[model samples]
Target: MATLSNCFQPLKFSPKRHRFNSTSLFTRRCSVSATINQSKLDILLDSVKWDDKGLAVAIAQHVDTGAVLMQGFANRDALASTISSKKATFYSRSRSKLWTKGETSMNYINICDVFLDCDKDSILYLGKPDGPSCHTGSETCYYTSVFDSLHSSQAEGSKLAMTTLQSLEATILQRKAEISESSTAKPSWTRRLLLDNKLLCSKIREEADELCRTLEDSEEAPQTASEMADVLYHAMVLLSVRGVTMEEVLTVLRKRFSRSGIEEKRSRKLEGS
Candidate 1:
């Protein structure tokens, strides 16, 4: 009779040599990817101390949208592969293997931003995702399916800018879609304009040009609040269309706002305005 080892030669010897200790350190990754740039990554990775377990936390989101897509963990090799391949990959505790997110889902989004938490143990991703991140066809890992977020005064205090932006964008997109599919809404000017992609595109361009003009008209004179609001709203609409978020745009604005108004305005002129 053959020994048991003869039937399972590979498993018999390899288990001893590998000495792998399994744990409940499972990572849930997004079906889509978000990028973490070298600069933000430099700060994050440098702050974290990987233990003997060789595991670190990573939170994935859409690159352009800044939606929290999924969360995962990384070993040294997985981190390297994520940056090297420029794709989201994670070490799966349940499966006890390395798995690239979206391999089965076919909705893998590319990376746009990677960030490290203050402690550096956690990583955050911001990117444009393709479709649902969860296997069950949910949009996010958290299954808090359908709750009212807008028009609640209490929510206003707790709203994250990005979260609010995401919600608003979704609402706008849905309404725009509804308007598009309706044949009897032609009498409604706003509905008609929203339905017409070309018209929307033109409005976006016009607002962009107006913003530029307002910025250059005079350094000391800020545009009328109405004009500014128009520009901002239209820009947000365009951003939603492009699968970007107001959060990312605000990040740029925050950086710009840090400088003296005159200094910032002058710098733009210096760059061939």
Candidate 2:
């Protein structure tokens, strides 16, 4: 099992200065060899710093799909337990107990690389999750992320949904290729879209406008999740047809999130105005 935290960030910490009175502190002398061995077990990393509450935050990631599982707080024992079991187990600060991740749903997040912060008080466990890490029945604690593939870990529980999405994405690609090949012999709608840039762009624009124009109606009938899925799928095809990868779209979104409100709006306005 591998962890799939695709992003990384540098950490900075500022701690208050303190003076240690060595004279008042008792020093226990031990054999040089024994001391060295103890040092190994007692080692702390700046990466895994314990927080003020003596708890460390652990983020779990999926390996192949690179989906994030869930975040938890871990005491030493919980960390050790996860390492020992090769599965996620955390200390419940509010419950005052241990929480075995996926215990209820059997969706275990297997650890791969464990990154400690500069202070060695926290950890980042990168790996693939077996099933939904969140108990709320969503793929992630986050309700929405444009990178739907990043929801694989959580969607593992919904075998049907996961399979359908995967198949749909693949099918769309294959269908486009097939349509392109057949279009050379017979100018079909799909072939025309591939050959005529203007037509393709017009169709994509139409789909986008239609998607934006339709609001989910709860009056006569509420919109089913499938309807939204269709809109999103069409949008994805529009991107694919334009030679844009999903990763690129997500990168733009990340930049948008990182920007301040004014900066963000200004950038968008610059593109338009």
Candidate 3:
């Protein structure tokens, strides 16, 4: 009898035939690739506490932002294929085939690492998505909240609700894009800041001073938080104007986390020297 690992060979499903009704099945290429030890992978797959259907919950999360992108089910083959391909692959229970996340839309999640939960029943695919993960063109799939879905006045709940920093960065980018396209449209505060360099610099200086004062004057927690928000907003506006992404900033911060602040500053100084 074939072992459980031998039973689930990763099926190369054609997205054209599976996702859409088309005559020709087009081949797509992914940028990421990897290889895993078969023996080790088989042993790990056998250890997983899969449900009766031989599937476990797999969640894809943004590597930089830690935002949950999408959730699906995966079997042994899906997991193995994900490791080898370096792209998130799921077992479509309905289609009964391997479904790579971005085969159709080209919004593939390029996985950096795979992690197993404490219970060994769930898997996490830590990755960076190339584009919007949701079918509705939102950044991530978990944008809608249960409370907002039921209580909001709008028929459809907000699909753009994300973490505060991600949301603010997106808003700033949107303002910049809108300002670029529509010259006559009324500008928002963010737009005005993008347009006027002197005003933006002044605002940044003002917010930074206020934020410092909050600590110096022993202001309330709320006041300090408010001042910090203003400073972050202005700084992010400057970043956007310079065409620098939040991801780049976050990547630098993440790198610095492995070292002391003094060490990081010293390295920067050395580079400048």
Candidate 4:
């Protein structure tokens, strides 16, 4: 339930001054509390097999969501810097130098833990990114649809795979804002839902009922999945309309992680009473 926003600190930089000369920011290393001992880190670094170009594949994954944020190459210095700074630092193969993620874009990846793959030829960095990982402004490097239809065709016909719920929520919030500002334009389905509370509630109820019905039929697995998607979408729309964020909902869910379902329901009922 932990979000990327909670993990990464926002980077402050002036667009006018540092926009052109952002390379210097990458060169200067920031201080972070080191958890790993120098000796242990040295041994770990030594075990890694750097390729001919003195680089190893570094995969940055979100610690909470288990989503691969981005992948790049890392040298010994890059790995060392990443550990020391508690920020994702990767060796830019194209630039042939060490570059910290979010040095320019201010979308830095806050490091939680770094792991070496079984082969020791690759590294996995568990972290949370401040913003989109890709330069094209997508959440991750993988935005293009390829071979998705092959897998999705087996279930629920063909639907676009939504990997980042946070990103989708952000888009919905933005659309709501745009609709509020626009006078003549037709409001999106999300905006319309936000505008009409009764209609939104009705849609959510309808979707939930459909989802329940879908679950009753074992042969309609794909339809069940589709209905589930509808239920989630409508529920999120309700949250948006109520001025509640997905992150707030996630925070609540995180708090309930230690409690049993019955205990949680009883506790909520007790609080209401």
Candidate 5:
């Protein structure tokens, strides 16, 4: 049996805290303390009963979103690398060697934590992906649904089955690529916006004003939501044009999570001054 203390140590505080002013305590990157017992790693590895081919089932899950990114198998070395490097690594059964996720695609997964199932036969890796987890360019490996009766209903609900921002970002990237590849590619509103920065900025302003109007009509929740979506979409377009990712924006938000809104504002003011 492996204990948390034996496996890893708590994160150390940085001497320069201002560098992490926007980041939350929980979001702070931690180092695997030297105190971690080598015997503990051996104990964990020994607990797993690998298949005849010397592999254990490993599932990669999104740390924040709780989405299952992908599944693979891990040999002893792969598993050890994953733990030590804090990156997802698995054994490629076909290649008969260890493979690190995102090595070729640049869509690496940063592992936050790891877990073992009750049966101790399977491993779960919780991580944040740098880009699309699937080779097909989808956010997750399980994008297609074979039998999803609730899909239609879920689409109408407040919470979407898939992340709207991620989908929109992927679409924006595709449109940008298409436009770059061929000028004659059917002109899309998004493509046009991406090409003309001034027009995109204007559209964002227009959408933001419309969203503000919708907010005045508190009773019209659906209208407000629609207007807000338009604002978000345009904002995303601007971000895409600037070669900024949604993840980068989310990282800023994550950093501010631990601070009060007023404190954050004051800090910004101080910094500007």
Candidate 6:
């Protein structure tokens, strides 16, 4: 009778309560990040010297190839939006509104960073283009040069637009692509090298030896440069075959630049371990 009375007593339960909602936490973190970004944008915008029309000349340049892609005018909103979104934006004089590049064409000029000239009147948008940056399907808008057009002695639109190493790598990649399409086409030296891994490696070794010998033999500067160029070209071909980019190699080198050679080697060994 006593146990029955105790059992019949009111039953109480306690449920654990969560202190935070996942969705709300995420929203709060996003809000904080947005606030910090806004503060930075505000500081940057205040530094630019906007003209009477509230516009500044903005020039877009290729981040990789160092080509001047295009030029436009950007108002405060356009500049702010560009920094926020990391897309090249401009204030169209005719449209009288903000227009982002590639909004309609889908060939975006992705901004990597922005620079202000000494005068602070002009802005440089260092970026990479998805495709041809010009409306006429040209790689860059400033393709035609008055000096080059008038002078016949100078090579017209030289292939030197891209840096030597990058240009060589590009050519190697192009040769790789063309090999499959045009099997019957005349086999180039690069094509032969790509087809034969052994030959490519052998050439790289041979060129490297020659490069070293230039110093050993006390060769002239031109001879050393020639040998070094051969070594670089062959090494770049090997890089292309491995599907590695020059930028990737440069990034690793850049990381090592800040550290001593011995320290860098030790770090690599530790990483390997």
* Reference-based TM-score of each model: 0.51, 0.41, 0.66, 0.56, 0.56, 0.60
Error of 3 at 91 (Å): 0.7
The global C-alpha lDDT for each of the candidates, from Candidate 1 onward, is: 0.54, 0.53, 0.74, 0.68, 0.71, 0.70
Model 4 has an lDDT value of: 0.68
Candidate 2: C-alpha lDDT:
0.53
- Identify the runs in model 1 with alpha carbons over 4 angstroms from their true place: 1-47, 126-131, 142-165, 177-189, 195-226, 232-273
Model 6 weakest lDDT span, ten residues long: 1-10
User: Residue 206 deviation, candidate 1, in Å?
Assistant: 8.2
lDDT of 1 by residue, 1-273 (tens): 101111111110000111121111111222223565778756645567665677888788754445576888877666666665556778897887887777888655444445667676766655444456666555556433223245443432222223544555544554456565776643433344454679767876776676677667753354544455555555555665665646456445544544688997898899995
Q: Give candidates' CA RMSD values in order.
A: 19.0, 18.8, 13.5, 11.1, 13.6, 22.6
Per-residue lDDT of model 4, residues 1-273, tens digit only: 111232122111111111222222221122236466989989988899999988999999865455577889999999999898888999987788899999999888877678898899999987666776778666667544455445555433222223467556656666676775887766467767778898888887887887787656653788777777777777887877777756456435544665588999998899999
Question: lDDT winner among the candidates?
Answer: 3
For residues 1-273, write the lDDT of model 3, one tens digit per residue. 001121122121111112221111111222334356789889999988999999999999977777788999999999988888888999999999999999999988887779999999999998777777878776677655676557767635444445666666776777777786888876467778898999989988988898899899999999888787778878898998997767667655655655689987998999999
Tell me the tens digit of each residue's lDDT in model 2 across 70-185: 78889877876666566678899889998888787776665544667666666877654555556765554543433444755553322212233334444445546667466445
Ranking by lDDT: 3, 5, 6, 4, 1, 2
| Model 4 CA lDDT for position 60 | 90
Tell me how far the alpha carbon of residue 216 in candidate 2 is from the true structure, in angstroms, after superposition.
Answer: 52
Relative to the true structure, candidate 1 has a C-alpha RMSD (angstroms) of: 19.0
Looking at model 3, residue 89 earns an lDDT score of 97
Show model 6 residue runs off by greater than 4 Å.
1-40, 145-148, 152-160, 169-196, 209-228, 239-273
**TM-score result, candidate 6:** 0.60
Badly placed stretches (over 4 Å) of model 3 are: 1-39, 143-145, 152-154, 173-192, 206-228, 251-273
Could you give candidate 6's per-residue lDDT for residues 134-211 as a string of tens digits? 786666676554555577566354322345555566667777878988878665777778889999899988888888
